[model samples]
Target: MNYLLIENDKCVGVCDYEPNVGNDNIQVITYSGNIPQERLIYVDGKVADMNNYTFINGKYVKKTKAIENLLNTNDEAKHYLNDTDWLVIRHRDQLALGQTTSLTNEQYLDLLTKRQAARERVVEYGE
Candidate 1:
């Protein structure tokens, strides 16, 4: 079982072993599942992702993503780059074969522009 190390109302971290420390501000909760890095652990052992929700008045409330938190945004950019890389490769291979590629020059340029923008965003908000 995984244990959530909750300090105050926030889930500070997770541990596999049971915590035996004596502190009024610290609490632990156990569950049988994969706990994400940023998650909220309720007193009843319910867990919620911090990215999509916020704890308020002892309940989890839905909220919009904060712009300052760019880790997820950077990851999304990287994913976009990786997922569309095959299109570029295919375009190159078709050109080498002296055949008409499925992707037009305009389409290829658009993809390149979008990929460049994604890369720039990742750099601007680096991990």
Candidate 2:
């Protein structure tokens, strides 16, 4: 299975390893080359400790609850928008004219939350 090599709360790289077959120690192959088991913390991707790290797509990302929540909420909001009539010309016209759009309360809340989260990210990242 794939694993993440962590040292000092930073991801060193990714590697493959099997635990407890014949040896307690396993060599982790990284971009820099093979790293000894004693020099890194190996986190198995199968049972991830989400409090520390998260495996996203094909890479390991550090787990930050606030960022995760923001991303999840944004994805949900985008999905809802895509699945609804929000993309229709009539809806755009209504929004442009300051008329009541077809947005549901939940959708509006999700958008609001996403906006707040984005602002927070901008402030945090100073970009």
Candidate 3:
């Protein structure tokens, strides 16, 4: 049976075997053996309970669905932005001259309409 090793009321690691002889100085054989008794406070439940937590930084932290979703969303957004070529446009205002930058799809569409109107003016005036 699996056992969770607790240190200072926090789960530190997991062990496969519980000590056979004495409970006073119990030895838990984890992936990394010879964990000192000073760092080991107690042993928690079996494998079923251990599934609720993830081992991180020598401690078992509770895993949440929300945190997982947020992490996945961030990864997907990074990939999407990297793969896609976003449109860059310059602002038309005289005050913000000499600045060119990429814009989102909505901003690009707005600028596209203005550009089409300017093209129409050039065609009609021959300039």
Q: Which candidate is the best by TM-score?
A: 1
The alpha-carbon root-mean-square deviation between model 3 and the true structure, to one decimal in Å, is 16.7
Question: Would you estimate the TM-scores of all the predictions?
Answer: 0.46, 0.29, 0.26
Determine the backbone clash count of candidate 1.
0
lDDT of candidate 1?
Answer: 0.75
Top candidate, metric lDDT: 1
Residue 54, candidate 2: C-alpha displacement in angstroms:
2.9
What range of 10 consecutive residues in model 1 has the weakest lDDT sum?
37-46
Checking candidate 1 for backbone clashes, the offending pairs are: none
Model 1: CA > 4 A from native: 1-68, 124-127
lDDT of 1 by residue, 19-92 (tens): 77585677778868877766555534567667766444465555655643565777799999999999999999
Please provide, for model 2 over 1-127, each residue's C-alpha lDDT reduced to its tens digit, 9 standing for 90 to 100. Answer: 4555444344455657532334423343234444444424345523234355554555556668875786676566556555543445555687789999887657666766765555454422211
Q: Over all chains combined, what TM-score does candidate 3 have?
A: 0.26
**Model 2: what TM-score?**
0.29
CA-only RMSD, every prediction: 9.7, 11.1, 16.7
How much is the lDDT of residue 83 in candidate 3? 41
* Better-scoring candidate (lDDT), 1 or 2: 1
